[model samples]
Target: MNNGVNVTALAVFVLFFLLVTVMGFMASRWRKADNALHLDEWGLGGRSFGTWVTWFLLGGDLYTAYTFVAVPAAVYATGAAGFFAVPYTIIAYPLVFLFLPRLWSVSRVHGYVTPADFVRGRYGSKALSLVVALTGILATMPYIALQLVGIQAVLDVLGVGGGAGSNWFVKDLPLFIAFGVLAAYTYSSGLRAPALIAFVKDALIYIVIIVAVIYIPMRLGGYGHIFDTAAQKFSTPKSPGSLILAENKQWTYATLALGSALALFMYPHSVTGVLASKSRNTVRRNMAIMPAYSLMLGLLALLGFMAIAAGVGSGVKGFNAQLSVPQLFENMFPDWFTGVAFAAIGIGALVPAAIMSIAAANLFTRNVYKEFIRPDATAADETRVAKLASLLVKVGALAFVLTMDKQAAINLQLLGGLWILQTFVSIVGGLFTRWFHHWALFAGWAAGMVYGTYQAYGIASPATKHFGGSAANIPVIGEIGYIGLTAFVLNLAVAVVLTLVLRALKAPVGTDETDPDDYGAEAGDPKTQNAPVPAAAH
Candidate 1:
């Protein structure tokens, strides 16, 4: 396996890539909106997706390129610790099931294009909205880049190394072309592009996973040997108590899992999928069943162990742990099946990448650009600005991949999880009651932001010298734990204390535009009706 392109794999990847590119552009007409230029039309696909489409969109949004690439990689390298991705997904569904219906209902009623718009309407504070949008955009950048990292993993296995050189443009030309197609179609088709492509992505992913899970274990002398072999490898002094979480590492795993569960739905990309649903019922129905994806995730994580069992990692040159699952497929399967698996991984990057860019773009347009720059801007203006911002977001993520090592993308996303978790006090709490003062919420966010950043920056790991990791020492628990969870605790406590003190001081709590009835709204409910357009939706 020299660093030379495999003709068969490259051919398969190009055909699938071109297929989705066409589907993405044509999706602008899918369930064609009467006026397809507005945010509601372009950004949210006219907010008319039913159960099936919403399922695929949410699956594509949450089960990302990172999950497919990183989860297995983590388990292969760190043993039971990597299973944090498993419980996080398991717990996230129930939590989102409880709250997302309300978010969807209120967003549809208020014509909120992004979570930041929800914050602005609920708290009536553009300042808080900007903070929310900025946090979301900052957090999403690493995540989007990680998707490209996943694509690069597949590309690397197919014998495309981009060759180490200073000719950056020539070396990264293939990556540029792939994402350029992504940015172009996402700009034209908007949410509909991802909503349609998600079906294809999920189908390919399901097919690949089922085949791998069933076929790989049999080849590895069955599942029992895979575990036994993994246990032996992790039993050395360098990794004492590694196959299972050590006594001291339990808190780290638990906190990371809980923090991740909390942060998952809070991401703007996740919210974008929820808001695109036609009805609140659609959100609930999908959450009820999204655990099916979690099941697949557990299977995928096992691939890491399978790679170790097959001794797949030792054979390859330039082997990264991130390539565990991809390299495993290439080693175990024939060329045609390897081509299919590579295509699946490649397509998987596109769905979440498109949705995330669109989501981040919507935040900048509605909250930052429109709210700050042009208060009277028309809907058409917002859409146009979003299309361009989406392109820039992709470009920023691409730059992240080319300049830094791939592990940095994962670490940056860990930092992002800590930062975005601060918004729970403002965004999630605002969904239920108005008792939490917006000013207090902002202060809470600041406290968490400062504390989490300092902690994350101080963390030193093997990958980098500073901003090294997301796990840190817990304050009260007196153990290593996830920094994000600790920060959220700070955020919630500050919001609580400040809410009481501010009320005593007679500080102004902003007016809430949404009524209580809006929380229970479903499709066709009067409260769920779209708010009057501001002349620009025409």
Candidate 2:
């Protein structure tokens, strides 16, 4: 386990990296659209992805390398609580099955590229859409940065980079190079980059997980031995007990899963994935089937227990718990198989990082640039701006990876989810009902965002051993709780109160910018033909 790089294994890893990089750049031609220059084409793969393609694309985008590394790592450290991720994902598919079809219908009917675009039209408020767009872009950047960290962990395991006193620039050079390639293909191909590369990413992930879950257990003795050893080790007073929920954690676990399930489809990146589908049925069918990824997640989380049985932490010092899976495989598997698993983690990072950057860039271009800066921008002009914005977003994420501690990715991602979840009350709720006034919604969003940040800043994680986000200890509530859910409650209360006040005062609630039927019409349908093109972007 103290060994340096294996040259043959290193070669395999590099070869696969180059192959995937080529595949990523070549994606622009895979499903070449008629024009390929418009936002609808470039930002959303021409809105023409079939069921299988979207299944892979979204699977790749959502169940990421971070899941592969971090979930097991969590299990290695904490036990059953880590399985929170698995149940959350499984619960999510059922909820997505219910909500995403409505979203897809509304998006396609209006030719929406970003959810904030739909929000703008539905609420008739540029300010509200701007907030949602900015939140999406901000939240997405940290998630992309986490993907980079996933790749970084694989490289560190492969003995690629980093050493004592290595400058930040030198330590992270490989990550920067990886980010550069991702940013390039995303700039050229947008959503198509991840769409094409997702096939490879998911295939490798499945192969590695199936092999690891079965192969590693036999190597370590048997599945029963793995669980028995894990129980013995963790059953110590300080360890996370039994592979089941403790009573205190059950509420938080269930609520986190439910809240995250609600917030998952609300993410702009999630919406970007849905909007790229060819039809509403594609979205629904994909949701119905996507829980297969959750099953994979369950298998992956068990690796943490396997790692424990392997005595993964017996003597290691200052070791990253996050890197436990990679190290476990490196110690247990043959060199060649280890190489393949590492590459799976590395390439897994690239797929979603590309898609996330593309999604965030599209939001900035359509919602911010065209809305405020260049009202006369053409299709070509918007695509070019989006391409450039994609690069900036990647560079920003790279800056985050380098300047902050590597472990910051986990905390930042939780913070990002909390920030974006605040948008749900306005964006998701507004799609079904116009009951909430636009001005009131904006005010509520502002209040919720502040409360969410304050709570997140107060959270502490053993991973960082510092203050972080996701769950917070509310003062009067007297214990740690989920920040996003708390803030969302505040947001709803404010919106309701302000709406009633406005109704009583007979204040102008602003005219609806979109008609009801527009939510159900296809792009070329007569209903949307004469409706004013949305004047605001992100």
Q: Which candidate number would show the highest lDDT if scored against the true structure?
A: 1
In the range 443-472, model 2's lDDT, one tens digit per residue, is 899998998887777666665554454776
Task: Give the local distance difference test score of model 1.
Answer: 0.88
lDDT scores of the candidates, listed in order: 0.88, 0.82
Model 1 lDDT tens row, 1-538: 4467778877887888899999999998889988876888888888889999999999988888778888988898899998899999999999988889999888888889898999999998988899999999999999999989888888878877466763877767778888889999998999999899999889989998999989999898999999999999899787533788888888999999999999998999999999989888899999999999999999999888999898977755656788888878888987777888888888889899999999999999999999889988788888889989999999999999999887788888889899889988798899998998888899999999999999988988767887887889989878999999999999999999999999999998788899999889888887665554434454
| Candidate 1 structure, TM-score to reference | 0.97
Off by over 4 Å in 1: 161-166, 315-319, 533-538
* Cα RMSD to the true fold for all candidates: 1.7, 2.8
Q: How do the predictions measure up, each by TM-score?
A: 0.97, 0.94
